[model samples]
Target chain A: MNCQDLQRLVHAYLDYELDLMTSLDLEAHLNECSACRARHAEMRALRDLEARQLRFHAAPAPLKARIARNMRAACGNDDARRWRAWRAATAVSVLALAALLAWVVLPRTLPGPHQVVAQSQEKMVYHIANSEDVATALRNVANLLEISPDARIVVVANNQGVDFLLRGARDRDGTPYEPAVSRLKVRGVDFRVCNNTLARRRIDSSQVIPEAKLVPSGIAEISRLQTREGYAYMKL
Target chain B: MMPHVDAAYNLAWWLVRNRADAEDAVQEAFLRAYKFFGSFRGDDGRAWLLAIVRNACYALRGQAPGAGVNEEFDEQVHLPGMVAEGSNGPFCRNPEDIAIQHADRELVNRAIEELPVVFREVLVMREIEELSYKEIARIVDVPLGTVMSRLARGRRLLHEAIVARMKKESPK
Candidate 1:
């Protein structure tokens, strides 16, 4: 009923956190006391003001993709997900403990360092989806090599674009893209294919061009590389 | 129903204060949650998921490159240190007129970043995420009273910080 007692319960009252009896008492005190009434109003106003000012920000696209990818892996196969997670973690940490953890966790047939891509700052990933854009992406790759010869480029193929990585697969004009892919590989470009796409389409990995590598998740890999690994993303 | 990843990611983001660390924490949390989904019997998926997220954030305590990294939260120690914001006073200044012009989303975010991790977590969960007190208490593993006090103190500190920032930016 007093000011001190009111202060103790004012916020609770404004937040509707008080019990029925306490709420009634607080209302009675506020009705009798103008100061308590004003305090109640300001508390509510301040709460609303702060709520309006401090907004909730949604997760960015890449982070969501990364999360969904990891979640899907978890829901799919426990052991496989754990192994793939270690592989992804290996991409992040180069510390001794990290290396030790990887060594302890990895199977004897763990993928070699040549297949391991730790994307440094100067690296980029280009995605090509349409047959029509194969030449355009190749041209872009050629232009990129000319502009930044030291750039470590990764060309990830998924969906219909996986054809470009197939052995003897030709461009829209019927000229084989293999020659360009081979030349780019010699120049240090990596061509990664989506295993999910290949499996869904019943294409065997052995049938893929020998130079190209197979990745478990294409969109997820692209998202993780761009978001976490700082790879520049270009869609052709 | 599973909680939305955005909810988990936002909580981690508020705690870690960066996209990379937040993503890592969220990713870890989701994996842990998925693996333990069979053990979860409660209907409050958001709170359960957030507890996992909070655990993941704690795992990144020394590693996260953000404000207040050294201030590991000790409830017994900090319970007395928080300045109690008494809400019993005559309303003199109009709440409308006390606008901090520079209190954009970023400034508000920075203000929140400056708060101690304990208070910051509760405040974000209650205010921005709009979780009930019971839900917050469950997520934080604290009592209802604890959640209320931290929330009140957090608002006071944040309000003060925003006003101070505005004053500092004003022409001298």
Candidate 2:
């Protein structure tokens, strides 16, 4: 609590940040030190002079308005609610335009279902509803195309194709297609059942082929694959 | 909150040294504080705002072509406040007293402004703003020891500048 110590502590003392004992000790040092006391007095005087001279007049009303305008210009408009609504409307319009173009161009882009069986190179995919002999129909198509028994074929069935890919609750003749289909999957020929058809026919997903992925809207999915993915589609 | 605002304005005024510029800086600091409020979790809020003000000032410096770019400054001559409307007696009592007060304030301001930006900022925050050593360190993004040392150096420089100006003004 000497001269140098008191000088250093002036800032801390003015701030009233020191604890009681430290404050008392500093006060004791100040009482005995005249030079330090004068230094402290000068510092306080300087601080007071600064505070008085540095008076801040509030920004004039016009200046505040100009600054607020400048801030908004620099940072972009802060109107979240208006921007959000505008964004939503723009998105909806874009989607609607896309759907309209797809509808207008779809028919011209695709070959007929019967033409698909004849012109396909590798194999043709057939999505059958409910037919009495879907397997026979598929075998005929495969033979006509001179496809081997092991050629890659995808059968997407609702009630009809589901039973063909899986079981029909009763086996077709003495031949059960599920075991043959499972063995075909092992050989890489894909078989899938339509979940949409299964739902319509009141059949559960488990009743279809276990390996089959349930396409939600089977007809739209079939068209999508043909138009979008270059897959040829055929009718049995 | 009021004290912190006062402290920040004092520091800003000392740095920019114009009421208009200081007011703009403080307003910008408040807006920035609101925008980045989420990021400040465990810090002295006042120090954090001052740090943001420091950055804002720098941003304004770069954006505006010549603001804060030049340390050398010339005081603007003031317009005569009152003049006799018609061909009357004198040019309204000379206005020398008012002019002197304005000149003294401007001299002090210019002295502060003449310091390098870093030295001026540290001095203003520590002395005029009355921030703690730790708060100054945080605001300036420097070490505590550095803040203490800089505060001492900055004060010395300011005192020297004021004394030199006073001596120049007085008769030799």
Candidate 3:
């Protein structure tokens, strides 16, 4: 093999990805050519140096422990539900009796209006165009939802959302709520702001929540969240 | 949570480099994930959590851009002394063994952090996490070829950094 051919195959050969015939040809060439052999050795040495240096620096143990803790705290309540289910399995007879009594004693409960609307899956993120301050847009949505200090609503706004935020009215608290539109961040409800929208609005990263990341486009991110991630967007 | 903890921690570790930062990022990611769990559609919970980790790292850095860029190394130094005081001794196996193990880890992490933000992300996903190129492309919102090219370049750069470091350490 010529020098160029040998060089081309060198990386693949090192990785053992070269086909048998090509591998043999390269091997033969290396045997005959001192320069290629030396070159190959250098590459091999470089690869070895990298492997040795490729340290698994354990992430700070405290951090690992913390993540594990939070994830547990995050997922802990879930296991409770499972335990409840298992208990229900063992006490099926008691549950049946309690259900019968409850059914006879209480009036049938109907779903609330907001609950119906919330479950509709008809939420569409309106692409508000060319305004400024998406965080303010989110704060506006929170206000529109009449988001109180303790009450949080999922708000996903991106580029156009910025306009919506800029135009958003103050809550009863009289505080201008800057909506923190994160693409997949939900403080308790999912909210996404478009990276594209932020760009269109000429807002830099500082204006938005660090949690609010730049997705490709606000509208597309919204659509994907709704269809792929199952978030329902509502225009307030 | 138990099952996913290791994976989540690993991903966070890769992204933030520093343990404290990684922990902070992961914890915040979990909180955000939990609050947003209702929004999760399919089962790929790991990826969803990782997406949150990515955001958290951004958030941490956003809090202090200057600090994040420095990639604090002193945090690792306090570990050995802390381990001695603590009951677990150390989850890092043993101290002498870690010296060798940590050598490579430090290099990998330093090299990774040195990479451009875009390339560092792809390398973390592809190499550390072993994600598919397509999946990485989707997460980073780049094209497949861009992902591949970035991965190749990232590896090459990582190799270059490692070799340089080794040369500096070796006796002349």
**Docking quality tier of candidate 1?**
incorrect
Better of 1 and 2 by DockQ: 1
- Cα lDDT of candidate 1 equals 0.66
- TM, every model: 0.51, 0.41, 0.40
1 versus 3: better DockQ goes to: 1
CA displacement after TM-score superposition, residue B8 of candidate 1 (Å): 0.7
Best by TM-score: 1
lDDT by residue for model 2 (A79-123), tens = 433322222222212122322333344575553322232232334
Worst 10 residues of 3 chain B by lDDT: B91-100
lDDT of 3 at B55: 73
What is the lDDT, from 0 to 100, of the residue A31 in candidate 2?
A: 81
TM-score, chain A, per candidate?
Answer: 0.48, 0.43, 0.32
Q: After superposition, how far is residue A83 of candidate 1 from its true place, in Å?
A: 18
Each model's lDDT: 0.66, 0.53, 0.50
In order, the candidates keep a fraction of the true contacts of 0.25, 0.04, 0.12
